[model samples]
Target: MLLTIIYIIAITAEAMTGALSAGRRSMDWFGVILIACVTALGGGSVRDVLLGHYPLGWVKHPEYLVLTCCAALFTILIANWMRHLRSIFLLLDALGLIGFTIIGCQIAIQMGHGFVVSAVAGIMTGVSGGILRDILCNDVPLVFRRELYASISFVSVICYWLCIHFGLTLEWTVVTTLVFGFSLRVIAIYFGLEMPKFIYQDDDEQSASSKDI
Candidate 1:
């Protein structure tokens, strides 16, 4: 029940962010719903499909689909207010990412998967939606550059694994992972911390490469 509530919150926040992306692209209502659903559910769907998890999430619980659509429409109604609240959205996005990762980890563990598979499931749960969103919006995927996003997800999964391995209760595991993951992500955002980038450059002006990305 707690996990289900968290999942609802995660999808709602994600759909809001996705709607903002759609608004930036000046999409119609249909486009807004499409992007919102993709951003909110795409990751979990990808993970489920890869793991051969039957029935799928949205198929079993169509209410999630309705929630995303409603959240998208709500975002559209408050578009201007949203622009002024970037930091709030950032925090929400961080929460959503961590929440999704935790859920993904739980699902994999329930399915009798091992640590590595759970970690991959966690990462996919975190970033698959963003990848689809970026591609649809015609922007380079955020996970591919300029941020510690995907790495944060992987690190969170590691933290969750450690907590479980150390014999922590499920509640403690969830709280620990959520706090650890959220802190890392917000700190990364605030300090502009990121992974080292490898720029592919020609021999000519090879040293002209910059690190702005």
Candidate 2:
């Protein structure tokens, strides 16, 4: 239904952005498609597996895989222009994050899971695609260090739950989650907001010995 269409748009946007990442590495056509697929669908696949939700979507509807590959190929043709449209891509990426978060929460809710599991599902769906893409591209996972991306997803789940708790309709919950989550994500990206980094010291053993003395 409406959710399915939004999911399509989300994956299309994600695949295109992921193709740009492949372009950065100067990967071959196959590499481009692989990265795009990982970025667009890996999160949902992981979420389903973790929740024991079988017959994964892309598996059930192989056309979704075809869509991502085609989107990546199309992006290759427009790679140069994408550089000038980085902001647009950022917006789309943020939208994808919110869309994924909402869908994940919905799926978990349908399964009658509690709020904690629902929250985990939302975060996993928001975060895993980028993590897979980064690992494949040999980049640090952006979710682990970038702007409040995963945190926003977590927050979105809580907000969605609250909306349902207050007896809001599906339409209201969807709109509110999209607006609130997308706004928070885009603002965090614009402001370069980040959680504190935990820097590891190479002098750990030395510090421990000093403490013993």
Candidate 3:
């Protein structure tokens, strides 16, 4: 039930963002719907496959299709609110990331996976759908950028595993993990936290200058 709520919220948020992007690009309705669908189902599909869940979530419950269509309709109507959409994009993405990660980790643990694999599954669940959306929408995936976003999911999953190891209730563990993941992501965005990059320097600048003289 919790997973269903998370799926609906995440899909709706993704639909809104996707609709804005598609509208900005002047895509047709077909393109908009395609992006919205991909954004909504891509991550969960991959996670389910990894966890050996056949037919997947949306397939087993066709109500998810109805929900996705509703989300698409909402996005189309509210497409004019593009600026406000951008303003809330980061926050929405963070919420989706935290929720999906927590849900994925919980599912994996329930299936008897160890902490390490559960964390990996959580990371995959958090980022893969966004990657699919970006690919379909012709943009770089946010996870592949230098940002600390995906790493935040990893850290959150680890914390969740620790809580479970200590025998915390599933509900409390999920709640705590969601809070930790969302907070970390919000902090990273606020402070512009990022991974390091390669730097290069001239090794023979002095010798080259003397020879030029």
Candidate 4:
């Protein structure tokens, strides 16, 4: 039941993000709903399949689909009233990412998975949906580009693992991790915090060549 609620919230966040992006692209209502559902469900589907979680979470709980569809539709209807969909989208996406990361780690731990495995699973759960969404939308996934992205997931999972190791209750551990992760991402966005650029192996050569010209 709790997972179901989490999935609904995840879908709502993705729906808002998609609707906002779609509006910027001038996509119609159908496009918005489709993108939202795909963005929200894609990662969870992959995770379940990879973990051999039978029936998949969405298939086992059909109301999740209903929730996704409704949430996507409702967000689209109200999107026009918002003056700055971009900001809202960023906030919602960060929140959903945080919740997904925490829940994924907790679920793995509940199933007796090790900390390393749970951390990786949590990062995957947080980023994979957005990756798939961007791929389908023909844009680069934000995870691979600048911004805190997957690092936020990594930090969050680590915090959760620490709390768990310290004898903290599962609920509080998750709560703290979610708050930490969400706050970090929000701050990163607000302050334009991002990953450092990777200088390619031949960046020096390229720079030298350009300078010579």
Candidate 5:
């Protein structure tokens, strides 16, 4: 029940963000709806396909797709006020990331997968939608460039696995992971923290490496 609620909230929030991205590009209403649906449902679809899980979530529950489309239209209506709600949207996006991660991890565990596969599932579910959204928008994917986003997803999976391994109740584990991952993401955003970039200047070493390749 809790997971269902979180999933709904997460997808709605993701859809809104996707709509906003489309708006930034001056896309039409249809484009907004398309991007919103992809941003809300793409991650789960990718995870299910990779796991060979039959009957994808949106496919099985078409209402979720309806919800995302509604969310997209709602965002368009409120586009004027969105600038003032940036912080709120960021927090909601963080919540969605952790929620998606937990849902994916739980599903994989239920399928009797080991820790590594579950972790991958969690990370994919957490980040892939935003990746698709950014790609469609022609922007760099935030998961790759944002401060501690995907890393937090992975860490949340580890925390969730540990909680379950140590006999935490499912409810408590979800609550704990949500708090931990959400807090980490909020802090990362506030601090503008980011993973170190490896900048390889084109020089003799790079030229030689390219030639070898």
Candidate 6:
């Protein structure tokens, strides 16, 4: 029940963000709705497809699809007021990231997967929606550049696994992981903490070799 509530909130937040992105690009209402739906549900769809989990979440629960579309339209209605709620939006996005991560990790664990697969599932669920949103908006994917986003998702997965391994109650594990992950993300944003980028400037030799090709 807790997870289901969080999932709804997460998708709503994600859809709103996606709608905002489309608005920034001057997209029409149809584009906004399309981006919103993809951003809200693309990650889980991808995960289910990869894992061969039959019936994607939105497919099984058409209400979720309706909710996302509603959220998208609502965002468009309040677009003028959104700038004042930037901080709130960021916090909601953080919460969504952790919620998505915990939900994904739990699903994988229930499927009898081990640590690594669960970790990947969690990270994918947490970040891939935003990636699709950015792609649709023609912006670089925030997951690849945002401060501690995907890493925090992975850490949340590890935290969830450790809690379960130590025999924590499922409810407590979910709560703890959500608190820890959300706090970490908030701190990262506050401090502008980021993973070091790997810049590969083409040296003269490499440039020449590429030119020859």
Predictions: Cα RMSD each? 3.9, 3.0, 5.7, 4.2, 1.9, 1.5
lDDT of 4 by residue, 1-213 (tens): 544465567777886676556667777888877777777776777776777767876798777667777877887677667666667667777878878888677667777889888887788788887787787677877688868889999999889889988999877886788789889999898888988888655476597676665
For each candidate, what TM-score against the reference?
A: 0.92, 0.92, 0.85, 0.84, 0.94, 0.96
* Pairs with backbone N, CA or C atoms under 3 Å apart (clashes), candidate 4: none
The per-candidate count of clashes, in order, stands at 0, 0, 0, 0, 0, 0
TM-score of 6: 0.96
TM-score of 1: 0.92
Against the true structure, whose TM-score is highest?
A: 6
Model 4 TM-score is 0.84
Q: Candidate 6 — which residues are off by over 4 angstroms?
A: 208-213
For candidate 5, give the lDDT of residue 53: 91
Q: Candidate 3: lDDT over CA atoms? A: 0.78
Model 2 Cα lDDT, one tens digit per residue, 90-161: 888888899999999999999999999999998898889989999999998878987898899999999999
Each candidate's lDDT (Cα)? 0.92, 0.91, 0.78, 0.77, 0.94, 0.91
lDDT top scorer: 5
Q: Which stretches of candidate 3 lie over 4 Å from their true place?
A: 1-3, 198-213
Give stretches of model 2 more than 4 Å off: 204-213
lDDT of 5 by residue, 111-136 (tens): 99999999999999999999999999
Q: Give the C-alpha miss distance for residue 74 in model 5, angstroms.
A: 0.9
Better model by lDDT: candidate 1 vs candidate 3: 1
113 in model 3: Cα distance from truth in Å? 1.9
